[model samples]
Target: MRKFSLYMASICLLFGCEETIDVELKDAPPAYVVDAWINDKMETQVIQLSLTQPYFDSSEPTPITGATVTVTSEGKTFSFTESQSGSYTWDPATSTDRIETVGSRYTLTVNVDGNEFMAESELRRVPPVDSIKFTFKEERNAFQPEGYYAEFLATDPVGPGDTYWIKAIKNGIPLNNPFDLNIAYDAGFNEGGNIDGVVFIQPIQDAVTPLNEDLDEIVPYKLGDSLHVEIHSITHEAFTFLQQVQIQTQRDGGFDEIFAEPLENVSSNIMMMNENPDVQVIGFFNVSSVSGRGRKLTE
Candidate 1:
């Protein structure tokens, strides 16, 4: 009996001392992200903005519904209608039928779920093109098996340092794609918002040499030809500040910093085909990615 007792005690000691244990770690908290893109298609008569709902966790984003959205721009106000699948629509009228001043600024206001946001935009005017001429230059590129030269030119009354949208018309049709380039201002202050300059519409992929393709298709401007040009407004400075409202005991980084960045500038222009009146100009431009700190206008 004593030997059996001792054996039992030994078994209990071994088993109890060798007992297994387990533990599990909790996962990290999820993050939040939101993005808004301005629709390029709707520019003149209407401005459409699309908001994206980013994931808060590993799971898919839950739809945002029953939220009121309003936008104000250029002294005009518009509201959004909840469309299918997280889409919204609105059209705000401007103060005048014509586009605002080139340097004049426009403001955009957004409201969602008791939270508000704002963005600013600038309008730039397209400088007039003085003349269209051509020049010859030698080029050495492997892609161009044949030794070629470039010939193309469009002169603006104002020199470089300005942005422009250039287009061409061939055989009574406006070219869908026109080469867009920035002019370099030579020694001028870029003052008064005008520049006289020259630009060459080289053959596809040949910047130095104009490819001998369809002359009507390759050339953007012809001698003594009248062309259409457009320059957009721009804004370099942007900022936002947050306001705090105390609620529960939890002191969440009150009035913390949010998005602090400038938006991308945009411009569009119209080019006329002197020879082809049948062709028309259909173009658009706008700024986007507008984000900043949310400060109550009333506050």
Candidate 2:
């Protein structure tokens, strides 16, 4: 009986144990990522190119080198030279004739290896920021005490569909987070809002206040801190893309997980001109007329 029991125990140990299974995840093909922007300043227009990395990659995206980039505007063609790794820049200082003006249409063409991509944007004018105001609020979150919140006093153009991308610069550092991304359509929160030809509404004005990334709460300003506000006139397409990006960032992981929208890629203006339809291009190209105002905190 002991020998029979030992034999059954040996069989159970050999067959009933957990086994590790190896998962072979197929590698996704790389896609070209283009982060290209042009403002009314037009000193040195830049376009950055890189290849998308895998989902689990913690490192920066791989930059694509040795590409031909060109921009055409006002019946003239301007070529860009590689100033750094995967970055192409066109300096108008070398030739004063290559200025980017409002209402001018600019076209970008890129050729890398055998793949080609093209995009076009028209510069739109933005309303000047008359002034900026701030208010101190009592403790709203347990993480921190009272903080300063900023608001803009600018009138929207008397036209419908006038979209904008508002950026905050605190002490020379740009507040670049999903929460800091403030976009308004026709002086309202978004396209659905009918407010126009007036000062920005309360919600739109309050959205520009900077927030702490680590604590995920509104950050108060210190004495002598400089706050600069920049407003960029952007296309409706660009506004939609940024809105989607904000939604994606906010829905990453929270109580709203069940109400999150379906995952979708950020729309890009660049189109593949090559015959290979399988090759994909990502990111956006934007041309904006920027207006800015700055103030320092005294109290």
Candidate 3:
């Protein structure tokens, strides 16, 4: 009875120390977000414009409509007409549609309500995806039961300063998780690694494989599953921006993230035309050369 009384008293003390404190956060103005990534694929290109919302708002982003968008490369301008709310698109007529000379800078301009925003990017070269192979595996654990695992194969170009974003699509659905983001600098990660002119490292080559339900590493895909992989060459600035975004969004909750530094806003390449920049633009613009290949698991 004495011990039970002490336990009750301890629980009361612990409960008494807990109190709900409402954190009053200051309101900040909204920033324009531009998601403009053009690739040299025989498909329609799209650019989405939207505004940022409050930190705690769980609603959809407010789209910016009635905006004029265009891209110019090698003295030739291609207009992007508004297709729907906040989405601007440009269609390619033929498979051999070439907007302009490669390796030249492409400038993007957006006008919204008399305010102008501009960004520039160069279409970098990309290497072809060689193949996608599947390997059979036995039941390893609950997360990774017996299934077929896939591996993407691609060789980087023989030049440094080349960066790529490896995109994986499973059964037509893109693997858009932050942890699935696979960006490469030359043949390895980051610049100045002295690694180039070779095949992509093992980890990157296998990035097309899907992750388990926990978003952790596990064997993904099975018999009759389909996988598509694409490599999109990106600019250095875009690479940096994506790197920062991945770092900020990819949190698994552990000791390493416990002492992590406070989150900072990722930098953007888009700039406004106003003298004081009344409305800031936060996003990246990149033109890329892409190579992709698909495979279906049958074994």
TM-score of each: 0.35, 0.86, 0.89
The digit string of per-residue lDDT tens for model 1 on 121-162 reads 554444333333334323334433322222224333343443
Backbone clash pairs in model 3 (N, Cα, C under 3 Å; residues 3+ apart or in different chains), count: 0
**Residues 208-250, model 3: lDDT tens digits:** 7767657755756867889999999999999999989888988
Q: For each candidate, what is the lDDT? A: 0.33, 0.81, 0.84
Better of 1 and 2 by lDDT: 2
lDDT of 2 by residue, 55-162 (tens): 668898899999999888887787888999999988877875654477888888999988989998888879898898888888866654697777778899897889
> Largest TM-score belongs to which candidate?
3
Off by over 4 Å in 3: 1-21, 94-97, 141-144, 217-219, 254-256
Error of 2 at 183 (Å): 0.6
C-alpha-based local distance difference test score of model 3: 0.84
Q: Please state every model's RMSD to the true fold in angstroms.
A: 22.1, 8.5, 6.1
Prediction 3 TM-score vs. true: 0.89
Query: Which candidate, 1 or 3, would have the higher lDDT against the true structure?
Result: 3
True-vs-predicted CA distance for residue 289, candidate 2, Å: 0.4
